[model samples]
Target: MSQRSYRTAIVGTGAIATAHARAVRAATDRADLVAAVDIDVDRARAFAETWGVPRSFASLSELLLEEKVDVVHICTPPQQHAGLAIECLAAGVTAVVEKPPTLSLAELDELVAAESRSTAHMATIFQHRFGSGAVRLRRMAAEGELGRPLLATCDTQWYRDEAYFAVPWRGKWENEGGGPTMGHGIHQFDLLLSVLGPWEEVTAVAARRARPTETEDVSMALVTFESGVVASVVNSVVSPRETSVLRFDYENATVELEHLYGYTDKNWTVTPAPGHDGLVDRWAADTVSVPSGHDAQLAAVYDALDAGEAPPVTLAETRRTMEFVAALYASAFTGERVRCGQIGADSPFAKRMDGTGTPWGKVTAQ
Candidate 1:
């Protein structure tokens, strides 16, 4: 639908930046990778050359000043997402930011406020939500075909060794926000939130268990959704057996998705309850195969842009996911139930993921 291909630019030349470039290449009919930017000019130049992009710059300011880039992908660290997104919003350019979108609820609120003042938009990369399986499940839930959702479970169990955190910005609260709950688990859980509408409350507990980091290495939560659904959530980076799993049990069927990083239609399975075996045929009617990845989400983003509207995973929607993150952290730290919209601007949790301070004291070898 986009008559003119969007001249897109990527601002970070890190590991995840390649996925963004590949996504741009995947949507060649809708977008063009016109420029690359990084703090390391040589790295940016090499990335642009490798990706066949036209230009490279040492910083976003230089790229913004020189190129008419329509969309900028912020693939930098968690602390940098808000600033870069705000700059893009102010410059009248659309920004697609990698998660966790910001370091705190306050920063996300800032980006949301900035978007209200700009014509351009801010979108977060929750790619798993765009896959065919998730879409079908959400449609069924919406149409009341899945029956009353009763129970659910979401888990993001992945391994991250000490060497992985030695990169200077991997585990610190000031850098990556929280541990797996903020960085790694947010992907699958955001997909869960996408299907389950709004959450009512969270009661969580986190521990420093293994990692010698400033934040918790593992977290567990009990979440209650507004739809009368109760779900248990777990996030960890210390598990030897790495797996990302989600299971939804409705009155008529049980739907499950099992994958490590990404999922295809093949990774999803549906089991009908007694006397509801007919629903299997209905679920089988959807045969589309959109895998969970940046390409699929970016394709959808371009479609929204083409339709003269803000992109998918926009600020309004991201706020809900982020507030969930905040609530989980608040409940984990304070030993009390945290509800939706409870952590306002006055709350310390709004300022940082660890709030005023963490129970772990300092980053000592534990």
Candidate 2:
């Protein structure tokens, strides 16, 4: 709110907290890193020292009460996101929280309610949406270059060893929500819903082949979009090589995105269909392409903030994503097809998981 740049505070000092620190430091004149916080004082001090931040706090209340923070980057895990973000909003500090914004739809709904009652600018940190390929795909879809998207597919394959789950909250349902689907696959899931619009229904099944958790290690779903497009989502934490890809089949041609950190070409292959030469010609004539990524989206955030407009990834947009995950979980639990936009605040799935222990421990090593 000051011309002196947006004073910022990062509320968690884990690995992601460091990345947010770098992002804050990397932000242009639009934002500044003012402080860092963690429940662990030493960790907070280490992050503050590393980032050259002048302030450190053991809790959000201390930072809110002491720091002149305009924005808060919530780098905590999913279960911790809702409360901190609500506090930040109530403190009149804008917030950019990490993805899978909350552990359940109910938590997310409460967050939305809190944000609605506040004037703070709130957004989810879906950095993948800021990536170049994602931006391009969204633009094409908007311009109708991808006409009446008929089919969509997402494949996310990443490995997570036993040690990766050693963290106290890593594999538990109450803390982490679900395994790959809710934790790792969340970004891709958000991107998919963003580019493809809303899903009409989802039928999913999950497996625990790799990790020891009540949550699934591998999962796949058939998503039917409201536009009559059918999509498949494949998420796993035990693939040999990491790969995240999205493919869309439209009336005129096919569009694909390779979701890597620094994607260069962001290839969009346009092949004229049997009788759709005119559509191909139109795309060839009007389509303008460029290299894009998280930087592009981040720039958009700064611009929106400067212009006093809402951030592109608003709470409303993210709520649908939470619903998507909620539906997937509901479908998995009830063994029935789950419809989107139907889970209510009083839904049984609203409650947190048992958080007892990792489900992968149940099976002996092969």
Candidate 3:
């Protein structure tokens, strides 16, 4: 903790690991990219070379043995996240895991249990919440500048063809963790939860409708937040016109965000209600132009780590977001509304998102 700059290692050599490395590189004052690890050593070395990392190893244990790292970026698949993160956490290395953080709530709980006994911590990558637009929105709402949030809509609609799921992990229940809702829509809905606070209940429906995947490719939910705000949520990978959108209708204004993947201040639109026009100028001044990406979030993470505090997207918050995902699936499959804290350790949904034993029945990969 006394180090001026943390030594960071990336524990996966996939496409997203490059982003993690670059984010670390961007904040040279707080962190240094020291190593890369992958089961595939060749890929790990190439990744290390591209990122100017000093070391590469075939496994995290090897990397830990060879280098003293303060932080680890877990950019591996959903199935491998908990194992790598648990190992890193036990070694007192803060782990920044990519989402869907685990394949099941049980697995995520294992991570929480590991962190409970470790000096270090684990944070999930929900970078959408770090964007300037999102920050401004939350600030405005908190200060009552946006008035009481009434209704909202969260949508993550994009296209991923059959070929895209050809990868062993892309569209499987056990691997990717339940299609678009779990992998893709999670970012948007997490942003919604960030803005609206605790969600009270969810009534959802999911369908395999088009994708040849074992899990649902499309899902819709009605989320009721604790504050009585109702949100319409949709996660789809079948839409050809790709877009991620969230709209908040407040007593004083209507604020919206629309972008494909990541977003910035420009992607936001704010409109004040009648006689509340002062918010127009305030909104513009409030937006400071930080884009939503790994870099913005990592800067905050290091800031917390340097202060010996837990990082952003704390596991408690992560559990809340993840719990909503489980509840949505439970509701979808059970044909019943799910409420906050309803999926206990005894519930099957707590064990797996598809724990209701396949909603539509007998879905096989085509």
Candidate 4:
């Protein structure tokens, strides 16, 4: 049987929307960018023209009404993700949403319910997980070549100035969900969760040290996984020297990835333990290099759609990652260690990230 080609549309003409369009264009064989949607008609038209999309609409409803879209990339703000995704799923169109999929676990639950009622599925964009280095690390770990993971560290310490947060939605808890933890660090930590599996508990601290936002500018957490691997997670937007780094210490070797934003195979390093030096040859011999970015993940999504299967970064996987975000906030604000499954339907953290309210007293005037 021949593989089916997907007609994809992007809803939102922001900067990230262009990345989605480029990724769609790159996978010419399996997907085509047919339309673009945005509240600003001019912006939509401009984006459509630049990306070679045939049509542009001012709203998702209008685009859905006219275009034969098989997949819709929800690239709007975090606030609109749940509603837009639910609408697409109701129409039997798969949704590919960006990170921090929804503002809260409750909202994500709604998306999950919508998916259950429709033939379509929803996937969040955690592009790092699709990178070849990540793929290789996971394969080695599974094969017992890396041995048992004992310790890990994930740091997303990127710098964002006051002007960046001056945008209405940038740093607000009610709008963009949370600060660096939700918007930036999510990618690296989601990759961490992908490799480590289920988490058992989390103890965290969040503070607004510099930025003039409603959310924390810096946050740190100690996460314990069910496999007994412990990890230190740091999310900060105030650092001058920005870096996205993840290191895993296993029984036989130490693996590290040092890069900002995205990574290729070259960014990864595997150092075998003194007694296990022979494993170094095995690592060097396994040659596969694919960069981490939208293109890699979009290709996987289109392939899954062609096969009539759930796409990469499935809703269930995203939910766990989002739940971890919730646990981080819950532990940070309440000054209590939070366990997995602790933030259920009744938990305030499930309803809103700042459910218990900001731990820091008030945002002092700049």
Q: Is candidate 1 or candidate 2 better by TM-score?
A: 1
C-alpha lDDT values of all predictions:
0.92, 0.76, 0.90, 0.92
TM-score of 1: 0.98
My TM-score estimates for the predictions, one after another, are: 0.98, 0.89, 0.97, 0.98
Error of model 2, residue 233, in angstroms: 0.4
Per-residue lDDT tens digits of candidate 1, residues 1-366?
536699999999999999999999988778889999999889999998999988999889999999998999999888889999999999999999999999998999898899999999999999999999999999999999989999999999999999998999888999998899999999988999999999999999989889878889999999999999999999999999999999999999999999999999889899999999988899889878899999999988888888989999988889899899999989988999999989999999999989867777643425
TM-score of 4: 0.98
lDDT of 4 by residue, 1-366 (tens): 357788999998899997898898888778888899999999999998888888999999998898888999999988999999999999999999997899999999999899999999999999999999899899989999988999999999999999998888888888888988999999999999999999999999999999888899999999999999999999999999999999999999999999999999899998999799877787778777789999999988877877889998899999999999999999999999999999989999999998778856443432
| CA displacement after TM-score superposition, residue 265 of candidate 3 (Å) | 0.7
Clashes of each: 0, 11, 0, 0
Stretches of candidate 2 off by over 4 Å are 1-4, 260-262, 266-294, 353-366
**Reference-based TM-score, model 2:** 0.89
Worst 10 residues of 4 by lDDT: 357-366
lDDT value, residue 289 of candidate 4 = 76
Task: Give the residue spans of candidate 1 off by over 4 A.
Answer: 362-366
